[model samples]
Target: MEKIAIIGSGNVAWHLCKGLQNEHIEISGVYSKTFANSQAFAREFGLEVYQDLEMLNKAEVDLVLVAVNDDQTARLIEQIAAHHKVAYTSGSVNLKDIDHPQVGVFYPLQSFTKGKKVNLFEVPFFIEAKNMELGEQLFDLAWKLSRKVEYADSNTRSELHLAAVFANNFTNHMYSLSKELLENSKGKFEHLLPLIFNAVDKLKNSAPEDIQTGPARRNDEQIIAQHLDKLEGDKKEIYKIISSSIQKKYHEKL
Candidate 1:
């Protein structure tokens, strides 16, 4: 796309704008319900600010990229699809749910935090469009930011999103839990960083199941009982559920 307009000024929007501009693509402007947000975002990137949705609809641009919350994505698409070719950055929002002619998905499959720069080239970009022409355009747009681009339908995108929750969200929660336990026991979470890095490093080449170690992986009942004795409430239940799952996976009696 030669010129693009952006909706929402959140983390995803911020990163996309940065990536697009790095490739010398012109951003027509940005729009947000809260004008101040768009103003600030535009100021930071030297872009024009669209004060209202009407102004955005009238802008001259090749595409409108919507990068907002999943729930709000469809509503915005419904409003703007007639005015411009639109794409949203949500994996869970189904494309069929929106009855639009020129709309698509441009989901970047990676966690984003404001001010934290990540290697966009390494992140997977999942594309979904109503037709092959639009699909190719979205793929070309994504390829400007990342080498990993693939077309995925709503069902496959939803499945990938679910897997992301387990791989990133749930794993981060486990780290938070580890920090809590460490602090309660007068230990530092940093002490476990090396171990965490080591485990992640192994995943580059080794199968997780094949390389698994620890009391649960070994079916060491005595150590498992000791760990359970130290945990309480939801933590204890979580431990039990996961340990039981691991044992079952290994064909070991619980």
Candidate 2:
């Protein structure tokens, strides 16, 4: 098994390490700038922790997975350029900015949290590389980690990142808003949990347009107007915009 070193101790790094471990790949060590984070992660994974780049470079590893944040990715790549085949776990960063010839992207398109177990096989991995050979290597790595692996160029990957912001992050914000509204009404937010789960479940079998429902889908103008009246503050404006968008989409489908 090829040895892997991860250069961050955040959610993405943690999850990636767990996935790689499940595949029985050897994790040589983990490098984090913060000693506490590095120590904690190292203890959990039973791997050495390096707080310095020099220490990490000394470790026996074939690949270095950089899971640092967007702003720090380029700097980290430069710091580790000469040591090993460096790959980042970012969907937004351009691979050209990194100096390493073997640099690539091994972006897993899923929200990760520390202590949460994520099944990598269910998550889509978007692989990219500077050359065809490196691209194939990245794809093979992705395939080992996920059942759904796709080869995407930089532009396509960036576009997917934008779409993810809208589909996942923005939608999550909307869920929080829903919870807030329900709480304000002295209603249990848990009531909507099943509906939320079912909405996502429906997406697996049907297109979003085909599964859409509520007043907009039925063209019930009266209920729409009533909903608009019931909504208050910024929420009312947001409701109007979303309803308008839904209405426009519904009309386009006609």
Candidate 3:
């Protein structure tokens, strides 16, 4: 595609625009439900800003990237699919659910935060299209943005999205809880930074199952009891559930 128009000026759009610009791909303009955001993003990128969906639908672009929220994505793609080649960036949105022939998925399997630049070269791009021709086109386009590109259908993409929630969202929540506990005990969260880094670094060489530690993994009842006694409410409940799961998984190995 020679020129592409992007919908939504959120975190995904912010990073995508940068990645496309780096590859010298011409982004026709950007459109958003919020006019101020569209103006700001367009001004930042030196591109045209479309005031409404109707205006964007008539734009001279080969592809339109729907980088909006998952709930709004299908509706937006449905509106513009007839005019331009459409691809969305949602991992959970089923391709078949959208009744469009030219629709596809260009899901980036990474969490994006505005102003926090990530290495798009390493982020995985999952492509799914209605037909082989559109699929191949998206694959080629994704390859330009990242080294890791794979053709995954809606089901596989949905599974990957679930895994990502556990790996990234749940893990980050754990870190947040750890920080809260440390603060309550008058301990510095920074002191645990090295330990956290070491735990993650070890996973690079060994599977999580093989590298399991802690009282729960070791099946040390006394230590587990002691730890559990220190926690209360939802934290205590979470600890109980996760510890039980870990103990069960490592039961044979222990």
Candidate 4:
């Protein structure tokens, strides 16, 4: 097991540390700008905590995982470049932005929350590196943490991130809006839980196009109009746009 240091103590850092710890990897220490966060994470993982970047210079670690926010990733990489091999957990950042030759991406394509246990071994990891040798090393590190690992170039990773935003983030936004609408109607939002689960369940074995069912799919202008009439304010406009887009997609299929 290789010794590892993590540069951030946020959700990604927490989950990564937990996964690595479970695999009996050597977590040398964790660093955070705030002592509180670093202490908390270190206590959880039973590793040392470094509060200062300079202190990390003395820590014995093979690789540093920069799990900071996307904007801070590049700067953090630069700070750690002189000390150890570094990798970031960002889905959108390109490795070229960092100066380290051993720099790579160890992006886990899942939303992480502290205290909420996620099975990291089941999550997909997208790895990228500056060279093949570094890429293989990063892949091995990722394989230690996950069973599903893929080597994707920056461009492909960027596209995957965009698709993920649509599939996960935007869809979650839609769910929030639906819940809000249901609450406004004096109905329990939980009523939609089964439908949401079933919709996702269908995707396991069915293509979205083949499983899609809506007024737009049937070209039922009457039902569409009724739905639009039920919606109010900006929601009505959103419904119109989404219905039109869905109709267009299904029409193209026809």
Provide the global lDDT of candidate 2 against the true structure: 0.87
For each candidate, the alpha-carbon lDDT, in order, equals 0.92, 0.87, 0.92, 0.86
lDDT (tens digit, per residue) of candidate 1 on 160-233: 99999999999999999888888867679999999999999999999989898888888999999999999998
Q: How well does candidate 1 match the true structure in TM-score terms?
A: 0.96
**CA RMSD per model (angstroms):** 1.5, 1.9, 1.3, 1.8
Instruction: State the lDDT of candidate 2 residue by residue for 189-241, as single tens digits.
Output: 89889999999999888988898898877878899999998889878888889
User: What are the per-residue Cα lDDT tens digits for candidate 3 across 1-254?
Assistant: 78999999999999999999999999999999999999999999999999988998878898999999999988878778485889999989999999777999999999999989899999999999998888899999999999999999899999999999999999999999888888767689999999999999999999888988998888899998998999998889989999999988879555
Q: What total of clashing residue pairs does each candidate reach?
A: 0, 0, 0, 0
lDDT (Cα, 0-100) at 136 in candidate 1:
91
Q: TM-scores of the models, in the given order?
A: 0.96, 0.91, 0.96, 0.93
lDDT of 4 by residue, 155-200 (tens): 7888888899999998998998898788757678898899999999
lDDT of 1: 0.92
Could you tell me the C-alpha RMSD of candidate 4 in Å? 1.8
Report the lDDT of model 4 for residue 81.
45
